[model samples]
Target chain A: MSIEVNNIHRIKPIASYIVVKVLEETKTTSRGILLPNSKESPQKGEIISVGPGKKSESGQLKEIDLKQGQVVVFGEYAGTLIAQDESSKYLLIKEEDVYGTYE
Target chain B: MSIEVNNIHRIKPIASYIVVKVLEETKTTSRGILLPNSKESPQKGEIISVGPGKKSESGQLKEIDLKQGQVVVFGEYAGTLIAQDESSKYLLIKEEDVYGTYE
Candidate 1:
């Protein structure tokens, strides 16, 4: 693992959960207007740590398809938010909460 | 397919989407207090129509694991809401938006 991952391992996700470092909220709209604390559902973030995949009916561990370092979009209120500090915040979401990943 | 499914076919989902019929909102809380228009996410609904599947990176169709008639929990604002009529309302959400299914 890399140093960045090591840093993120402080709060490892369990089960089918993943830790996501929230991106800086866009303060300005496309029209150049300021908007604070947008309530949009689909928010983007970078994946930190992924947990072991959920068990199947037959007790098989199906691995998650997502990878760490990938930027993904999910429902804003989908997961439990953890504020590491005053400036940094992370979200612990299930793998299924992720809608799509961006390149 | 059953008659119920045929009726739901009028609004067949495409791609990785699924049609969910919103359950009646609980008018009262456990304390018998009225709460209307709750803003919480992860609401429960019954699955109606499901899409064929989503195209993978290799352009293969990946079928959704959910089945019809299953009630699912999802972020309230995760999907586009469509009012079928005065009383019936549905949501069009991607397969990944579903958090879990209840028996």
Candidate 2:
């Protein structure tokens, strides 16, 4: 608790929220094509902590939602950039911001 | 338009929906991980086309749900696999399947 309380990189996620670290950066082409070949394989991020789940329109809890330690893909256009531990981070994107979770 | 109208990879997406082509594959390591050293740069996908946005519970349309030609990242656990033009593809992931769109 003390460790995370001090480390910005380490955060205590609220219910219905997720903690993810950027793992890769992708390179895009002039026509908005991401060259299959980037400078290298893009970085990968890990889901550290997770919020419980989102409420559905009918007011019931949504499904499993996001989980801790799951590798996720996100819409680059979504999310707001924030600085944590003096490093750039993003947060609170809608569940839609999450794409795939690799196994 | 004509090209997409014919080619399966070349799809005509509806407004508010998107058509994406997978460009890379991500490989995760043990302990719930993505090696980052995938066989190659993970395949990239292009938003070939899109569909009309989903309506909100209030009946208004949602934000730019998804667009054509936007390279996207998705959730490993989300989306149903479908075959278009007899090739493997994914679809209608509730707009939540999209992650980042590189610039």
Candidate 3:
């Protein structure tokens, strides 16, 4: 694993949780208007690390399907935001909180 | 199933989604301070209906452990709120968005 990947695991998310690095969104819209950072919009991020799945009714571990490096879309305010560093932040979201994945 | 249960099925939630009826929280705290409806706090709700689980990486449908009538705790602003009727409303959340279930 690279240094960036290793840094993500410093804080391990538990129980079907995933750590994602929010990707930088496009600053300009199709109309060439620059979107402000304060704009409210759905977010996309790349999975950095994932926890073991939550237990099922029968005590089996239900696996999360998302893999590391996969980009996923989530609602505008779905998960808890954690500041990993002055220059970066990460989101802690359950696997199912992800609405969809980018192909 | 009772009529209420049947009524909940009118809208079938899909893909690990669940329909939850927000419960009436305690109006007064243990110290007897009245809590206003506008006060923000984590929410608790009973599962009205649950959709089939999301698909796994292997293409199999994963299973959700929550059952009908089960009360679950969720974040303060976790899911989309849907009005079911004039006096009733429901929330649509993915199974993993549920933090815990009351036994």
* Model 1: CA > 4 A from native: A1-7, A33-40, B1-61, B64-92, B95-103
Per-residue lDDT of B1-103 in model 1, one digit per residue for the tens?
A: 0112223455545457787888866757889987665556467889877767765434456999988899988876677543233445556688888889978
Candidate 1 lDDT, A15-35, residue by residue in tens? 679999887545343334333
Tens-digit lDDT string for candidate 3 (B16-102) = 878799886775888998777586667889898887777654446888898999999987777654333334546667787888998
Estimate, for each residue in A1-103, the C-alpha lDDT of model 2 and write its tens digit.
1233236455655535665666544343223443333111222346766665555577655433456777655555555433344444545454445544444
- Name the better of 2 and 3 by DockQ: 2
Whole-model lDDT, model 1 = 0.66
TM-score of 2: 0.39
With candidate 1 superimposed using the best TM-score fit, by how many Å does residue A77's alpha carbon deviate from the native?
A: 0.5
Q: TM-score, chain B only, every model?
A: 0.75, 0.55, 0.75
| B1-103 per-residue lDDT for model 2 (tens digits) | 0011133443223224454556545465456676665333333466655545544433355566456667777654443222222333434344556666665
Candidate 2: fnat, from 0 to 1? 0.00
Q: What is the interface RMSD of candidate 1, in Å?
A: 13.8
Models sorted by TM-score, best on top: 1, 3, 2
Q: Give the per-residue lDDT digits (tens) of candidate 3, residues A24-70.
A: 55544434444343423446678888887787665667777678888
Of candidate 2 chain B, the 10-residue stretch with the lowest lDDT total is B1-10
